[model samples]
Target: MTDIEARFWSKVDKSGDCWLWTAATTYGYGRFAITKRQMIGAHRFAWETVNGPVPDGMVIDHLCRIRLCVNPAHMEVVTNGENVLRGEGLSALNARKTHCKNGHEFTPENTIVTKNPSGNGRACRECRRAAWTARATCPECGGSFSARNLARHRTNQHGGSHV
Candidate 1:
């Protein structure tokens, strides 16, 4: 094993949770219970111990499914996307809820998609619902508009102002 890996493994206890050294920083700035900094350090140590420096764009995945585990045997190199999926951190798994705060259910019929500069998809169903509600209430003039003509109603009947 590389010297760094040997040093880390020698200090790990049986449970593989605690580290020999307290990590200076944790994942997501302490969002996760496991210290990711220590995990990275341990991974670096392991990689150097057995295979020399890790190549660029290589991410270490935990085969043990334990974020804090530093066992060299349990670490494997994988793409960042694969690592995120393996860790269950994909956006699809944590997308916004189907219903808004007002209990309005969002479906394709009621949803609007906005394009991000990076060409990513961002849905504004909640915003669309809020706009519809606002058009109904006419927050400024307190008048309702027909659902189909809310946009024109807001700009014309509501003093030519966009909501």
Candidate 2:
């Protein structure tokens, strides 16, 4: 083993299925300082030590769901979306929700999905239309409509020509 690997292994408490990091940590996961000015997640450091560089746009997930685990055997590489889905935490629970919090069924017609800071999440299309209807006013026609309706309204009023 190399010197870096030795230092990393020294901090591991391998008495359990999940090899726990027994060193300084932030947010339950371990933190390793490579130099006076550099730091990286200990779990990540441990992974690269044995496997290799994690591919860009991919994240390493703790299959065991133990944030402190550094065992490469318990890790898997996946996209951010996949990682969130596989998690057993709050995000996973929310992602699995069949309806929005306000009881709107997340059908294809009523669900708006987009990337959020924490990967991807769905919004209620009905709520979006409602909000737009309540707040948006067309500048061209001084007409009241949701943004979606306003698009059609403009098209109908303007003889179906691009505005």
Candidate 3:
């Protein structure tokens, strides 16, 4: 084996089906140094060593879900979105929901596509409308007003002490 190959393999524990890297890790992924100052994911290194460079716009997904696994066979190349949707993260969990938390179906008409900090997301229109309507009522004076007029309503009707 070449020097880098030998160094890479030396840190792997091959006892299990998944070849676990037993060295330094970052965010659960094994870290390997290819050069004195450059470091890369050990799983990516293993996949590249076996199957060549990963294609642009594609990321390595651990099919085994073991971040420490460096076995190329346990990995797959997929888009970042695809990778996230395939896993059990919050985005994936939300994507799998056919209905909202309040039992409203996420139909084309009922679903509102929104931009969140993470990315695009779907919200139930009924729930959103209900929430907005709930906010439109003044709790102190029991008066109904538009959402834009909430502060004005409170200031004029309740002297701003109701907030």
Candidate 4:
């Protein structure tokens, strides 16, 4: 076995569903101190030691949801988005939500999509309409207007020549 593989096996307990890391940990996940400034995740290192590079934009996920699990059989390579959606956390809960805070169902016609750094989110059309109307305050008269009425309101109130 390679030196990394040897080091990895030495720290594993191997006594339960999760071949728990017996070495140091960070934030409840196994942490291996390779060098003074070369510390890395023990589970990730284990995956690399057995498999290869984790793949671009892909992360190693514990099938058993054990942060300390370094068992190669329990690891799967997946995208960050896929991992988040599969996890039992707040992000997963939000991803599974089919309705907006206002109780509007997220249908294809009524749902507005937004791309974010973490993932995409849907907004209800009714809530969006309300927001567009409520937020479109006139710079000239400070009056709110809906999307359909904003242009006419701006042109008529500002005399159409107000730059």
Worst 10 residues of 1 by lDDT: 27-36
lDDT of 3 at 35: 94
> Per-residue lDDT for 1-163 in model 3, tens only?
6899999999999999999999999999999999989999999999999999999999999999999999999999999989999999998999999999999999999999999887899899998888677657777778778776787878876674445
Range of the 10 consecutive residues with the lowest summed lDDT in candidate 2: 154-163
Which is the better candidate, 3 or 4, if ranked by TM-score?
3
Which window of ten consecutive residues has the lowest lDDT sum in model 4?
A: 129-138
Q: Write the per-residue lDDT of candidate 2 for residues 1-163, one digit (tens) a residue.
A: 8787788899999999999999999988899888768898999998998899999999999989999999999999899989977877788888789988789999999998889786777899998877776645666779787666777777788666544
On lDDT, the stronger of 1 and 3 is 3
Which one wins on lDDT? 3
Model 2, position 97: C-alpha lDDT score: 91
What is the TM-score (0 to 1) of candidate 1? 0.49
C-alpha local distance difference test of each model: 0.57, 0.86, 0.92, 0.85
Give lDDT tens digits, candidate 4, residues 1-107. 97767876999999887799999989999999776689989989988888888889999888999998998899999999799889998879987998899899888
lDDT of 1 by residue, 26-73 (tens): 552111122335345554564456666777898777776655555567
Runs in model 3 lying further than 4 Å from the true structure: 132-152
Q: Where does candidate 2 clash, by residue pair? A: none
Error of 2 at 126 (Å): 9.1
Order by TM-score, highest first: 3, 4, 2, 1
